[model samples]
Target: MNIRLLAFSFLISASCFSQGEPFRRVNEFYLKGDTRVIGNTILSEHATKVYVRPKGLNDRTEMVYIDIDADSETFSSSNASLDIPEGAKIKYAGLYWAATYPGAKGKQKTRGNRIVYDVKNKRDRPFDLVKLSFPGSNGYTQVQGEVIYDGMRDEIIELKNAAPYVCYSDITDLLVSKNAASGSFTLANVIALEGYMYGGSSAGWMLYLIYEDETEPLQYFTGYHGFSFIKPENTQELSFKNFRAVERGDVKTSVTLAALEGDLILHGDGVSVFKEDTEEYIPLKSRVRYANNFFNSSITINDQKYTDRIPANLNTLGFDLAQVQIPNKNNEVISNDAKQVKLQFKTESDRLFVFFSAFQTEISTDYYQRVVVEGKPDTIIKPAQEKIAEEIQQKETTSQENVQLYGKDGERIVNSRNAALAEMLKVPALRVPGMNSGYYVVNHVFSKRNYALKWKEKMQLKGFSPVRFVNPANNYHYIYLDYSKDPDALYERLLEYRKLKDLKEAWILKVNLD
Candidate 1:
């Protein structure tokens, strides 16, 4: 094997044997590169819907296959619905499905007087493909998904008889092609183990939709997928950051979680959020969810229950899906200014496997802004020459005739016939090919020239008329409010700019032009 492959195999083997560590991060999706500065570039409002195929025979029994498609003899199907707001643009859509498959059926073995089933003798098969039918479609379309996590390899040793696996598919293009955002969708042929197993058998699917609306506030949306087995001895915690919340507005933050193998009758499992100030973990609860039994197989958002799926069971036997708003009127757990938060999942008796989690929260408008120049529409004119003239005129009006004046760097200069101050006010021309070493008060950086120009125009509209940008060897355009050779002056200017609420994150960039 190759060197990288050998290393990965060793790591997996070591993790399987480790008794203390039970949770692992398998995959993460988020905004990357300079696009992160746009704030709302990847930010959007989102909605989550879930349904289960092969639902339980009863509230207490294990999961069983109940095919919703009566006409199809070979396919097993289930259905769910999607409700999106009118006129909202869909940004991304991801479909996720997970199941515990212990292989095909066979005759039971006679051990002494008892009939013992040998699950190890069965062949292992992981399903990486499923069929999806859009609303009003006549037939099912095959969707090939990438495996996010598969525990089948560790089944006999670690996961027992429940060889759980999760798969994810980016269905954004497929949804966009249909131009239908809200309708009944069907999923079929999800291969999973039925009948009885060591742990309870379960299978289900969930759809996450992220959309953009002009009326909605800018918000950060992030999703993570992995297979983590949580039991009485082990707990899972996920930390989120890189987004700031609005302090004054009606801040709304929510989280969606999906898991399998949680029994309906079992208790002593809950989810909590870590509060930094009090150094305590606050248990999350809703109208249907309790602090002790948070993962009891229910589909709920905020305090409202969702009953728009085929065979919508109050108790899903082993599947659980929940979306709850944080710091609601009843539960004031998190603050508005919290930049980071950690979610912890724990269970005292039940053994559950968590696969997917997503978070969404409103952000400050200062994260991104477009400055419109006063009285100028659709264009930005250079104010460098005008600003220079204005500065010289102001100095001449404020000082005594022929009096010595000081530059921004505290250098004294004699005002010889009003020419000294004008010379001092002239802007320096930087060399294109040579290094122009200086300190810059940068507000933003963009990889594209067009984005930099647009930002510069916006800054000009906001009365920062002398805003300048420079392109160095790194090829990224650095937009700055001021530039100076003196480090002290640059530091002072940076402090002043940072005082503005919108520019609190503004910083200094030391460019070694040489």
Candidate 2:
């Protein structure tokens, strides 16, 4: 028996055994509650060419570096533009970058007349730090990112030779501090393998921005990041819930996807959406994306290819970014009342890795109103007989349920609840310079304190005296109606404020000074 052949057979079987699982969800973000009126933008580091594609097999091509910043001293950098509409508020910003790093000391082995690179002794490096330059900045700022998926640390056997990894960072506070709405953004110091590897070498970065636009329809936005190796025989499904479409006929929905190591000429990969009304899956296709070759390396949104990046290669080699609008051409992929969606990705021949996904859908205007007033009493007037009986019953119940209360000084009070309310109304006791150690019934949140103050004044004009509390941690201002040390009392206040039409989406925030 040949020992080498036996070992190679065993390794192939082990790889097959690990090929069917889906991507692990590492981080997720959702815009609900007070931040439901949101929109999103996705910017990638690659450009879409007209008729050019990369040479050789998708996984065996030489990696090309994209450097657009002349002022930076980094080995690799890329720049892209962001255009946020005026009057829109920046709510959340996420930055993600990925690369394939097959260390320097890889060994070559022969398996069935083919040379295979074995990266068994690859050196480890810091894969969680990157440099970022904001719009109109002179120099790059070093940013420590969170490791979303590191194949070296996770030991993903299927992608061991390529050793792909992705990193993510929440740059909301940084962007908000700079007041960066629209401008050229540069990302530098992205580490990746520059030469050929067992699998194809690829590197790219993406910025996903979610903002609040009151002029646009109310939307529910969700974003997820993970790493999954997609093979020919495997299928990956992503499910999104907790949101529903409006009852109108012109509901709009979209999905954004990003992947690595996809071939431009490869075929047989497809994406599908589950239609709730039809009880079947519909293949998603656009003007540039075909039903059988959905993951081809390109950067397209809503049937339009974006060429707004430096060194805009029509073919991204192995990087893919697409934002496809659902129900295009009058296809009822999602119904008016559907609350959930499942997206399926499959390939019959090509192999790729999907790392990020985002979904957005327009919601009803009255959705928050219905949620706020679900259990509230009706405003209709009652008949004389019923009103008289209810008043008598209320008086008797009040007399029986009266309880004495005491203050911090041990002074007796007529009613416990009313005394607490009176003390709260007398002076703003919970108003602290910074975030206090208590629960706050928050009606609104703003990235800038000035904007928070403006909204507070507007609310005050409408018979509301909301207080503003600043969070030093994230530089966000919390505009709240009430606060208390007791969580139950604060929650009750949240419910009461939610009953009002203007404050229908009020929420609660808890802070601990310690």
The model with the greatest TM-score is: 2
Error of 2 at 443 (Å): 47
Per-residue C-alpha lDDT of model 1 across residues 1-514, encoded as one tens digit per residue: 0000000000011132222124343322222110000000000011111233333322223334646656454345667777767766667777877776666432345679965544533544448887888764667778999986666666435564556677778887887877856778777666666544554456677777777666666666766555556556877566776455554435567776555545555668777877653367888888888888776656566577666766565555565666666654311344444467676667787665655556677754443232111322223233432454465557557746356677899888763433422333344433434446776667888898667766655554444643444566558776777767975545545555666655677765666543
Q: What is the lDDT of residue 47 in candidate 1?
A: 12
Tens-digit per-residue lDDT, 1-514, candidate 2 = 0000000000001112233223333323333321211111111222212224444343444344555566546656766667778767878787888777666334446799997755554545566787888774557888899876666655567566456777888888888887877777778777776544565566677777778776767777666555566666677665776555665456677766655645667677788887653357789889988898776666676688766765555566666666677753332566454567777767787666666666677765455345433634222221322343455456546743254566799887654354444443444334446456776667788997557766765554444546776766577787877667875455555555666667887765656632
Residue 274, model 2: Cα distance from true site in angstroms: 0.7
Q: What's the true lDDT of residue 261 in model 1?
A: 41
Model 1 alpha-carbon miss at residue 17, Å: 15
TM-score for every candidate vs. truth? Answer: 0.60, 0.62
| Reference-based lDDT, each prediction | 0.55, 0.59
lDDT of candidate model 1 versus the reference: 0.55
Candidate that scores best on lDDT: 2
